[model samples]
Target: TQLLEQSPQFLSIQEGENLTVYCNSSSVFSSLQWYRQEPGEGPVLLVTVVTGGEVKKLKRLTFQFGDARKDSSLHITAAQPGDTGLYLCAGGGGGATNKLIFGTGTLLAVQP
Candidate 1:
């Protein structure tokens, strides 16, 4: 079974700070996705990367897929208080099932 692991399990920073979270796995995945979960809500999909070496940006957040498709990263620029949440990275097993393996997750807190 493939497992995704996230780094820096916890983070707390002031508003306007920059940070980067990483997701890595030994097995390669067909696609990778990033999500954010708040206190009382399910995770919200932030971005997805289907191709190796693909990079996608959403406003202040940037997502990148490694060249080998076995790793991914999320970088937040000038993070705001609203960005505080649990950051997750999921790998998709492309097929009929479309199964996904989620990483451990990163907890982020941005203080004002």
Candidate 2:
């Protein structure tokens, strides 16, 4: 599978803590998306960022795209146990196949 390269691949935090996860690539993407995956289900799309330097907020989470469309980051504030999951970023390039290159991922575990 294609990987987008993520940083801080594993994270262990207490409930109500804050964390930031990063996804990066040498090549620029047409768009980038973030997803949250639980243990037994398919990945759930969180947000899509198409423009450079754009930022979107969802409740306690914030998403940002790099200026050149080559990277993205996700920040979660006051995380809870319910937020524990595998967070992934998928970079969509302007290739013919339109394949989504996913990040290596950040496995977040929020302890109670």
**Which pairs clash (backbone N, Cα, C closer than 3 Å) in model 2?**
none
**Full-model lDDT for every candidate:** 0.96, 0.93
Model 1 lDDT, residue 20, Cα: 98
Give the per-residue lDDT digits (tens) of candidate 1, residues 1-112.
Answer: 9999999999999999999999999999999999999989999999999999999999999999999999999999999999999999999977799888999999999999
Point to the candidate with the largest lDDT. Answer: 1
**CA error at residue 20 for candidate 1, angstroms:** 0.2
- Model 2 TM-score, 2 decimals: 0.95
